[model samples]
Target: MKKLITYIVIIAIFITGGTALTGCYVSSKVANKSGAQLWGENCNRCHNAPGPGEFNNDNWDIIGTHMQIRANLTKTEVDKITEFLKSANN
Candidate 1:
């Protein structure tokens, strides 16, 4: 009976630990994708210039709208770029 309890406890620990670690991994992935740096040196040549960490409520939506057309970026690229900009908290 003791051994059975111990085994159950171990399994529970493993399950809980695994879940917590998985959450951390997921959060890190989101941060990584959002935190990606937008290189103005290349990105700006075709689009209006964006300052790193400069995307605030004042300009993010507008910038996102204008950039998609000027850069001719696809929806995915636009989303990624906008996400990155938002993550910059500009």
Candidate 2:
């Protein structure tokens, strides 16, 4: 009976730890996605997104700052989208 209780406790700990680790891994993956992917997923949610060529790099920076606040984007998402837009502008 004591061995069974110990086994149950070990399994419970493994399950909880595994779940926490998995959550972290998934969040990191989302945060690290390509800039284009982040832009598509997040920016498009509110309205039509302009093409990268539609604005210069400076304009993009300004627009990104505004949209970042309006859309409540994470810092990582804002950085990725800004990088993607600048790259696409060229």
- Which number leads on TM-score? 2
Per residue, candidate 1 scores C-alpha lDDT tens digits across 17-85 of: 987886546454444443244444337676566665776854766776676787665454566666666
> Candidate 2 — which residues are off by over 4 angstroms?
1-26
Report how far off residue 48 is in candidate 2 (Å): 1.1
True-structure RMSD for candidate 2: 10.1
Candidate with best lDDT: 2
- List model 2 lDDT by residue over 35-89, tens digit each: 8998888878988877777789999888888887888876667888988989976
lDDT (Cα) of model 1:
0.63
Instruction: Score every model by TM-score.
Output: 0.44, 0.66
Pairs that collide in candidate 1 are 54-90, 55-90, 56-90
Clashing pairs in 2: none
